[model samples]
Target: MGDAPTQQVPGLGDVVGYLDSPTAVCGQRLSVHLSSTVGPTRVRLRALRIGDYQGRGSRLVWQSGAVTARQQHEVEPAGPDRVITERWPVATTIAVDVSWPPGMYLIEIAPLAGGQPSFIPLVVRTSGAHSPYLVVASDLTWLAYNRYGGRSLYFGPGSNHTQSVANRSYVASTDRPVDASGQRTVFKMTLPLVRFLARHGISYDITTDSSLDATPAQLVGQTTVLIDGHSEYWTKRMYDAAVQARDGGTNFAFLGANEIYWQGRIERDARERPTALTVYRQAGLDRLARADPATTTVQWRHAPLLRDPAALVGVGMSVVGVHGAYVVNTAPAWLLAGTNLHKGSVLDLAFGNEVDAQEPPGPHSPANLQVILHGTAMAAGRTKPSLVTAAYYNAPSGAGVFAAGTTYWLCELDSTCPGGPTPRATSGALEQITLNLLRAFAVPRAGRLHPSAATPYESPAWLAKRLPVGGAATGEGQ
Candidate 1:
């Protein structure tokens, strides 16, 4: 085969790299590793405060001097898992100080001659942040889907078009380039919210899923912890930490669906640095049922660990490959107080991709669950349709939890979605609802002040009969 074409933008030559660590504390240091075909490269680092600043999408926080670019050795995937370890030489080292606020940042590297730049996502964390809200970036999920060296946790290395777990990796390394620098999830889910928060003057701190797994104590004393985007993977420590925080009256808002579904853990190196995410998928066979069943990499709701996510998030992912809109069930409600939306108002294209629904009033569900939005989506190859629900509940500890029941919620904040542009009116209503929830949850023990009203549709028997669509919304047992 001919020489591989350089990964470049516009006029720039190829240059790809990853940080020695995905995250760094404000006072710590981080190294940048790069392999470039470009003669000389310049590093332009920016902390993304407001994602879309006049359509630029970033604010220049920091920049580094031009560095010598060296063409490093081409390392391919090794071992049965096809883990690509990029042990490139450090081109530059950065000292993260007080100027670097704790938030999501992007490091852009390109040729000094000017070209399309490559990006690396970094989360600057703080140990003693007492912000009323905490936003946990779904870094683990981004790393899981990272297909840098032609392989990822979901697809094997090759030109094979089919994406199957059978040919996928059981482990994904953090020391390699993540496809597109994980901009897809970061921009779609986290950045929009960050922009919204900054615009609304909401003070919130940001951290990574790994940080939550490593030092979950940071979650303590916070009023609310926001888990946004497709947070699919979770470790026992992360799960327990969230539950503990919630029980301690720290409210939570899962702004996206398909969260806390898989069980996984971060494997650290000898130096105690996170090197890879190891998840040996049980895939329904419960292959590790006998050995360390508690830590098996199966669905959290599966056997050996009958911990249903719905018990925590108010709703669990029930359907995949879903495409539809959210049909309002109850408006003039607390969340929809300032919005123009009312019962039966359809938020077009608000539900797509994956979605969650409360199964029934069982042991896995919250006791006083209130369904805010209910709709239906037809899943692939299913004779019957599945219900999508956005709900809220007040825990016995007086902590409130809101589940958006759809992964597309965050993107809708900017009127952007997979299928098409979300209607401006619909986006405005959703934004108002989000603002209401955040404002209410910013206070400690918010449920005690503004508790969820009881709903009759919490029962499976009741939900089985109601359609909850347009025209009949008021009679859906609200």
Candidate 2:
């Protein structure tokens, strides 16, 4: 190329940055290494702000904005070349000192040299009584959701006519706060849940789509495991991190559903504009196979070939639509320990409310696997295979993998009508079963513990007695 076009080039976002130390103990000194292009004149590091995206009406606003500690630095001179490095001390106030709960944070950097500000999404994690550290990585692209701002992975504008019309007329109701109970977006539900956990003295960390590369060393200080609401996306790095943590004695629990299906590879332009993130689906299995066969394989999909196939339900694919009626088939597994169900007969325990036109099942179905619930399968209208639910245990690492058949079931616990606010006939029993399994998996064999403490929260017998009974509703059992 003769010469590159001169324009207002954007710098890297929050997720792309270096840190002085990868791990930090409680109340210790930590420094973050930040680099950016030196455009023409001196590029000065301005203020850093942290906030969450809120508001409605097509545009999002950062509801909370607070300035971080100030850092002033200059670029190193190198023969008309442009690039600078700066280090800022991270004390307790800036989130390195105190025990930062597990979760993702959006870090934004403003430049004084006049350009669009850059953001770096950081994933901070801690293991049980160990050190906590930050990990920098690229954002996972193509993962779909209802309210996270990008295109809906499953239910989009054209996915359903009624939904498309409603979305157009959808307005954020000021009467109800974004964090209110009946909110629509997964993030809305997740934010409050995080608040609830913090109030109850639960320690945790958050990793976002960008910082999916957070290593096991950064998560060794956490005790309880937590996955945010409707976290349906995953990359090879994310899968490896979680698997390693679980195998190494870290307690784990997925608060959401349909996780680790669509894989993405992070891509950044020379200007770090985040040009495009590529998605990869397996051969004969992508959503667009009907449109083009040559585009379905890993090479065309652009995502790293996932080595661990068990991490997904439909052989590393997405679960589309809802139509089946999921009942609590078994009420006696370790997942349902406290929920004392005597024998047979559990009902109305379906997860993932929004139903899509389902499709065929995957080829590698586990025969010996116990069916927790049963329901009708829908025809995959325009999407790929319809994965109802699946579970697998990695032989070598012994890490248990559970994939909800549908994405709507991601929020099986949210109390609401239609799906029902309170637990259904066997919903409580099912919840207890899940809790039991998680607890069992968390504790080591030598130090295993019960699903619940001294007195369990809800008894299985009590739940069975309170089960709801009636004829099936319209979409009860598709």
Candidate 3:
């Protein structure tokens, strides 16, 4: 919406590809499947650590120039009853080396002709004692909503763009490219935070949503686990592992909202790798539930399971989208360490459309969960006062769990929103809080997670907290 494109910077045509695996442990073999819009494509493949776009920028780590892609798009019908299947013959495979550090790496392939750059992302995981935090990507959620070729589970075939499902079945394949805009959570939500992490010299390992589903035990021995940006979908194993990690003293930080809200599982590719994410609409998922109850593919908090996400994340899904200022509800909370946000200071549009909250956290919820900050957004179409939340709770094992409770938490880090660029105070406030979070989390302790430490209230605190258009000197919303 600004002078530059917010995501999936497209060039001459579309250069697309997928990784052989969603993640790789250091010293393991990882493959990049490359394809292009033009024939016999020649491009430069460069690896960059996601960093501050508005400041230091994502820095290139390793690069190999003059790589060629020779694959052509191929389609095979899965039709005895299915619609279609799209596959690209392998163009080129790049073997990852042990020299690459453990972190989230974005492989950017740009045509020598200088066209739009296509990116393939993968987490370089490490189970060793070196790295402190594990940054997990929501690849499952990315694959869940990807509508590449117009065949997303939510939509019908590309030819029928009416948003109706009558024409297509409820399955999406990982064989296809990610939606043209790139993985929304990664590019827009997670990457910014990753960039923030890199800029600040935070040492962490990176893994994806699929990796968690495949082997959640990989979480053992980590100081903290970060599930940042739109981690809305999950497999039972992924959720359980994070819980187990928490129970075992591994801290869990949920930097974005709507995490673990849906239930889904992985379906293997032809090569027998778990590449596809399978989720059915409620009715379709109900049919599967009849066959195998454990594999039921539906919303987590509803029928058959009734497994509410709030139990793990400290908040549950309520509103899908809201646009408003984020008001500080707790001035004394340890999370607000450096920002100096008082009861009324606001972060302009810090809480985006989707947010999580207590529908009244039931008995199963963690007894120590505390409200960190309370906010209200510009409602899309609701009559009630909009409420967004930030939460924290500690486990007896010394592990602490945090929920930012809004998907827009990372998107606001750069002081830019869909409404246009916001005030510096907003960016400064959000960034400082995040820095405090990273610094606090890197330690083996949870900072300021106190159940009995909450203070008195400030009603409709938005009036006292908002940062005005030109940047305010009131030491409030920035």
Best by TM-score: 1
Taking all chains together, the TM-score of candidate 2 against the true structure is 0.49
lDDT, candidate 1, residue 169?
Answer: 72
Q: What would the per-residue lDDT of candidate 1 be over residues 60-93, giving only the tens digit for each residue?
A: 6677777766778767778765677878888888
lDDT string, candidate 2, 335-423, tens digits:
55576664444435454433211122333332223344334333444322233332322222333433344333423443332334435
After aligning candidate 2 to the native by TM-score, how far in Å is the CA of 292 from where it should be?
A: 20
lDDT of 2 at 356: 19
Full candidate order by TM-score, most accurate first: 1, 3, 2
On residues 1-478, what C-alpha lDDT tens digit does candidate 3 reach at each position?
0012344333224567776776776566656667676777788777765655456456566777687876566554364223234566655565667666666667777788887777666677666556778888887766766656545556555445563465444555666666543365566667766776766777667787787777777787778888887887888888788878777778778888888877886877675576566677473534567877766777888777678888778777756656556667566455677787887676665666577764454565566667666665434455545457777777777777788887767767764344345577877887888777666777554633533243333333342244221111121110
Query: Which of candidates 1 and 2 is the stronger one according to lDDT?
Result: 1
TM-scores, one per candidate: 0.89, 0.49, 0.85
Which ten-residue region of model 1 has the weakest summed lDDT? 469-478
Model 1 lDDT vs. the true structure? 0.74
**Model 3 residue 37 lDDT score:** 63
For all candidates in order, the CA lDDT equals 0.74, 0.35, 0.65
